[model samples]
Each structure stands twice: as C-alpha cells, then as structure tokens.
Target: MSAEPPVSLRELRARAEEVVTPEAWEYLETGAGAEVSLGEAESAWQRWRFRPYVLRDVAQISTSCRLLGHDLATPVLVAPTAYHEPYHPTAELGTAEGVRDAGSLLCLSTRSSRTVERVAEYAGPWWLQVYVMTDRDITEAMVDRAVAAGASALVLTGDTPYVSRRARGTALPLQDEVALVNVQQHLAGRTWSSLEQDPRVTYADIEWLASRSGLPVLVKGVLRADEARACVAAGAAGVVVSNHGARQLDRVVPTALALPEVARAVADQVPVLVDGGIRSGHDVATALALGADAVLVGRPTMHALATGGAPGVTAMLRALTAQLAEAMGLLGISSLGGFDRSLVEDVTHARG
Candidate 1:
C-alpha cells in the first residue's frame, strides 16, 4: 500500500463529476443502443468466481503479463478512447504518463485529441487503434501516421462503423464541437469532407488494412471463433476480444461469453486480448483465466480522469494492480501465468 491511504475507484468517479462538465462525464460513462448489451457485459463479469486454493505461500504476488510481445507490470492496458482533452489539458499525453507510471501499455485511438506522434513522444509500450476509413487513401495515411508515430502495433477496431448514442452519460454541447484535428488534414483546408466514410466498416477492410501496414497489425472487436481465425489468416499479428464497450450492437454476447471459442480458434498462433466490462484487478485475472492474454480498460480509467486527471488515473491503475495481486494471493497464485481457464468455472447456468 502507498503511504497515502488507498481510495476506491468510486471516490475517483465522484471526483470526475465534480471536475468534468456534466455532459462530458455522461458521454464518457454511457453506452449506445438500449444499453442491454452494456448491462450484459457487466452482468457477465459477475457470473465468474475465482476458486481459491489453500495453504500456499503467495505473500509476494505479481500480476505482470506480456501483451503484444511486451511485458506489462500488470495485465491492465489502457483502452484507446478519443477526446481525452475534454477532461484535462494534457489529454492522451497525461494518460500515457499515468499508464507508464502504472507499468502498463497505452493503446491510443485514431480519433485522439493528441496527434499520434504527440502521444507517442510520451508513450510507454503503446499501440495504435485504427478505424479504417472507407476511402483507401485515408486509410493508408492513417496507417502511415501510426508507423511514423512509433506505434509498436496497429490495432484496427473492426466494430463501430457509426457513432454510438450513450444515453445515460452526460456530454458537453461541444462534444460535437470537438473536431477531428488530425484527420482535418484530410479535409485539405476545404469546407466539405467528402473523404469521411460511414461507420459500417468491415473485416474485408481489416484484411486490406493488414496488407497495407508496415507494422505488425492486430484486429480489435473480434467476437467469434471464425472472426478470430479469419483475422489470423488475414495476417493480423493479434486480436482483441471486444464489443465496442457495448456501445455498439444491442443484445450481443458479453466479450467473456465468447472469449474461449475465439481463444481456441486463435490458439497459440498469436496473442488474444479482451476488453469490455473490466472493473477490478480480479476482473483482469478472470479475463486471463478465461483465455484472454491481457485486458483493456477504458471507462473506469476515464472515470479516474474525470475525478483526478493524471494523479487519479495513476491511483486507479495502481489500486487495481494491488487488488489483482491480492486476488492472486488468495488463490495461491503468484505469477500472472498462474491464471488460466482452470481458474474460472463458468457459473452462468447456475446464475440462471
């Protein structure tokens, strides 16, 4: 524990409401559609229970794990979310520093308020998440920028071809007020944006994107075994099990519900990571135990940012790591690898 008393992720959340505009907080917290999907993801997390072991020396526990071929001090990776400047002036730069300080990787979004290079300048083991534009030229340019920015991996988020309407979350009237600054170059100083594409992007585009990228590419938003296999065959170096934070598509299965099949499909060919509804360090353990190589966390981190900016983010991440270590100790586990599918017994039917 730090010399300072530990604060719950909840305390940070309340701080976020006070610090950020009501509208921005709402936007950061809400999910799209009827929100049944978001509810499912959270509920899915509850069905998992860690079967603890007895009489083992696990006093000094570690949650360090490797992701995209790099070691993360914890299984946590900061999920890429755009427009972080809405809460703080430093934007992704501050988030990157917090991620580094927490010994984790930061995955940045293409829609980031900070340029990918600007972000990479302060980054620690970061990856870039891309949204393949419908226009091939724009897509190519985005890939080039990520490479130029020193991103170690290219993650094409295949989900969300359109904007999600997160009803419960608050947002600034200026939420639409924030322009896509980096992509603004594509507009060529023109008043019109013919280059912009619809949100209905697809896997075929992901395959095309992989062919175009110079760096190792990973496909985000894989929810099925077949999609996972297809991504590998299409030359993706890795895949993320996600549901766009349940911000897209209603009534879909939680990421965890589908993790095993995708993990088996990807097998050892490449690493498989998962995101959506991760709340605690134990959730990270549960993800690894369910076959996810690492976990991506977004909203809760945003909640921290809304609450305390850089300092709160650092605290939130550190607390989760400590919780993860505690969970590992209770399970008589030491190393991150000690978590495997054997650690989780699916209690869904029992939950019913």
Candidate 2:
C-alpha cells in the first residue's frame, strides 16, 4: 500500500492518465455525440442548494441504509462499468475487494473482465448489471450464473438498446479475451459485439427476469417519470435514473436534473437511485434530498483503481461516506431518512 491515500478525484484522473493509455482514458471519459450531457452532468449537481435545518441534535448522525435487503455503510455504490483491466491489472477483482473493504456495494457489469464466480470470491454485497442480449438465452444464462454466484439483485440496464456513437467516434481496442470473461463461454467463439443488446426488450422483461432468477430487478438508465412508473408496474424492484453516465445519448437530461421527477413517480413503491457526475459527498447528500434512495459513482472509482488499486478505492469511498456524515450533521439530520425533497431547491430558479 502507498504511504498516503490517493489524491482528489481530479488528481487521480491526472495520475491515471499518466499510467493509463490515451485510448483507455478516452474510452473511460468521453461520452456520446457533442458531449453536452457529459459536460453538464457535474455542473448540474452544483446547481442544487441545500435547505438545511438548524439547531437540532445532529451529534449522532448515521450514514447507514438498506437496499435490496442488504445494509450498506453508505448510500454510495460502485456503478457498473465494464473492463476494469484497462485501468488496473487486478481488474474487477481489485474493484470488488476495494468496494468490499470500504463497506460499499459493487454492481458488476455483465461485460466485466472477470467472471461472476471469481468476483463473488472478493465482493461483499453486489448486484449483477445485465444487458439483455440479442440471444435471450445468453442473457438468461448469464443471469442464472450470477444468481448461482451470489449476486443480491439484477440491475437490468434498460437504456442501451444499441451502442451510441461516441463524440470521438472511436474506442480503445479492448480484446474480447480481456472484456468478455463473463459471457465468453456462452459466445461459442463469436465476437463480444455479437452479444448485442436486445432492442425489442420491453418492460415485461423486468418481471420475467425477477421470476426466472428469483432476485430483485432494478431498471437502470431510466430518465422519464412515465418510463420509471412503467418499470415499477412491470415489477421492477427499483429504478435508477441515469443516462448511462451520459454515454447513451447526446444532450439528454443529467441525472441530477432528471432525479426529482422520477423519484416522485415511484419512490414510495420502490427505491429510486441516480448516477451521473456525482463527485462529492455533498453531491450525495443533494441526491438524497432530491428524493434518491442512493447514488452511484462510476469514473471516480475507475480513476482510484487505476492510481492506487484497491486501497485507493477504499480510501475514496470512506472519505465520501465521512463527508456525507459531516453533511448530514451540518444539515441537522441524523440519519438517511431525514432527507426529503423539501431539503433542496434548484438554484437556477432562485430569485434575490
């Protein structure tokens, strides 16, 4: 382990760039066409002002929360990102061990470089992020393997019906050998892109997956309230308001801006989580105040993994959780339930 913890997220990214190839950096950082959504994601989080409550007992603030029957030390989760080997030699194994050590959860991607069983050996509480393939049988088989390997829930990524054109219009050439470990056996010597997302997948597939695997299913990449409600009606255990980290489309609403509408749509019925440009603990608190059950962090984790490996990830998660506790105390809230929509206001609409 290094003598010191990793630096701030910006520094981590800079350091990662020094060690990681330019192609890998571009694949990790850039998003779809025009990059408008990507550019606005972090700034969108900054536009919310906290309506803090004062003069209450906050000395005993707690950051603990429950999701999908598992207790978490913090609301921050590792959003499913593919091919960790590009960032770290340990691959998903290091990320899993880091998340486990930090008392957070990992949502392992269906495209992870590591196998479900191998990741389970190091991961603590984790969910399997699924991409329903052109071959339904392949998708189902993947789900079954995740179930057998001890994934707590299935996060059905609903937005990626097909790959979008990146603004750069190129990606690092990730060999199938390093990117398809989880699905390789099912591919029968075919290329990884052959396992394309099923464009025809409907809301009904959520119920079908839950029933088939006996695991709770969360629909990720939903932005519209109507779509969130539709997922719930079709038996979704939760809804993640995301634009696939702004990787799916250009100029889509950032998750911070889209969260409240989706939260109002189905938060009472199921957990509503959001991801996209969540950079700090204050951002996490703002997410909760906006009615999210939790928030997921993606690029930051990859940066940490690239720079400091597992220990860096653990340090970053701990620092965020600590910052959350501090924010809760400063906001005069003692627990996760204390946050509500009344606690935040979009600064764009504020008047003097």
Candidate 3:
C-alpha cells in the first residue's frame, strides 16, 4: 500500500475501498432508490460557470467565517455521519481529533459509535446531529446530554422520518458491540426498529426542541424555499439544505440546485448551510456564490478516515482549504463575502 495519503477526494475514496470490507464500503457508497439525486448533487455544481475578474489584488485570501457565533477556520464542516467504527477502529473520537486539527467544526451523528461526551473531549467546536425518535423523552434526553457534553449547536435532521430502500442492499448489520452509547440505556429492551425516526415529527417538534435546549437549533434536510421559511418560523437558528446525501429520497432536487431557493427564502434570517455532493473547493465556491453560508462535507471525510485515520482527515481538510484559497485568488476575490450571484451564471441553458 502507498504510504502517502491520496491528493484528490476521488483517489481517497478509491483507497478507502481497497482497505475496508465490501459490506462497509457499500454502506458508505450506496444511496437510495437508484441514486439519481446522488449523481445530480455533484453534477449540479458544474452547471454554474465562474466569472473571474483580473487586475485586482488577490493577496491574503481567507476562508474563515463566523457560524452561529462560533469562529470557523474554513466554511467546510463535517456533516453528521453514522457508525464511524465501520471505517476506522478509533471511530468518531478519531474523527473529532482530525476535525479539531483542521480548525473546522464537526457535527456528530446520534448513531455514532462513541458517546457524545467521549467525542467532546477533543478540541474543536462541535454540534450534535439528532433524529427525534418515537419516544419524546429519549429525544429530550439526547439534547440535554449533548449540551452537557459541550456541543455548541443541535442539528435536528428533519429528513429520514423512515429509512428508504438502498438498491445496493443494507450490508452492515447492527451488532451489539457497536452500540449507540449515548442512547443505549433508552434503547434497552426495545426492538431496534423502535428507534426508527418518528415519522410524525413536525415543525412543532422543532419548537419543542428549541424550548428545551439552550443551544441554537439547525434543521437539516430542507429542500424547498417555503419549508426553509417554515423552519425559521418554527425557531430554527439555521437551515441545512440537504437530501440526506440522496440517501433518503433518490429523485429529490440536488442540494446545489436547491440552495439558492432556500437561501433566498430565508433571506439571511438564519445562516443557510448545504451538504450533499460537495467534493471539491470549486464546489464550495459554487455553493457560496449561490448563497450558501457554508458547506457540509460527509463521504469525503469518511474516505479520509478509512485511508489514514485522523491524520488522513486532517490532510484532506487542509488540501480542501488550500484548493478553496487558490480558487478565490484566481477569481480576484480576497474573502468569502466578495462572492455574489453575479460571480456565477447558469451555462446549461445558454444558446449559441
């Protein structure tokens, strides 16, 4: 095996595939119902062409920004992903350490192999991603525990009320050893299916969570402009435009395609973040130009973790940051705030 970490996200994924078991690889790589949305998500960024300006000072490019009162070194954050143990033995703890080293934020999943308290031990701003379970008390307890464990924000995944079918089939079996430590007590004696997200969860639940927790609540999985406004009205501190990596509904609009609409609807009332098919710094630039405040990265982080553990993740983040900076410099923009809709244009419908 090569000692060096892969330079490109695509190469990193290929490396991960070589190292991990087929079952684990399938679980990470596959999306729901033929995955049309999955392919569209990454491809959507290409539809917008960048309009660069010359003869301007581009020195001192920076990717830093403040998100929900927290300073981020880069606009990139690790989107919540489940069961890291399938990729690396150190699991979420190692992922946390890696993100800390990258000077970015990490939104940990409720399905993490390590408990929130354990992952919180690492140095970084962290958020807890939650799924409101069938049991309301369990959901409340999770929010309280995550706050107590030092999470700065609560990202309520508004998608996945129920699991969707993956054409590749579910490969990773739920084993007792890798228990979801945060809610294991509440899960005791209950069938695993009981933990399936409460399909009935609604905007009222967002209100309830905001009332119960002091942390800012961000609703993820919003695709429409009207729904984005509804979440803010329901007390969401922010909204993440996502389709659960196209793992929930396969034909839903790509996050890149949906971001501008949601961002426009929210009208800066709350920060708009986006995830799904963000694989490069160019993609990050496109998202910002289209009105996203920041972008959340998922599978790339997992690929880095699988290839080289914490160090791999750190390198991947740094590489992405560098790529973003280079793109900014070439565009003659010195900061993220310089980005505007005028900087990007849809070329897909251009007539010659």
Which candidate number has the best lDDT? 2
Model 2 worst lDDT window (10 residues): 1-10
Model 3 steric clash total: 0
What stretches of model 3 exceed 4 Å from their correct place?
1-6, 188-193
Give the TM-scores of the predictions, in the order they appear: 0.90, 0.96, 0.96
Report the lDDT tens digits of candidate 2 across residue range 1-352: 1123323667777888898888888899998999999999999999999889999998687888998888998899999998899898998999999999988999999989889999999999999999998888889899999999999899999898989989875566778677667877888856656698989989989988999999999999999999999999899999999999888789999999899999998999999999999888899999999999999999999998998899888988887788788888888899999998878888999767
Q: Tens digits of per-residue lDDT for model 3 on 263-292?
A: 889947999999999888898988999999
* TM-score, cand. 1 vs. native: 0.90
The residue ranges of model 1 lying beyond 4 angstroms of the native Cα positions read 1-6, 164-178, 189-204, 350-352
The TM-score between candidate 2 and the true structure equals 0.96
Q: Note each model's CA RMSD in angstroms.
A: 2.7, 2.5, 2.9
- Model 1, global lDDT: 0.77
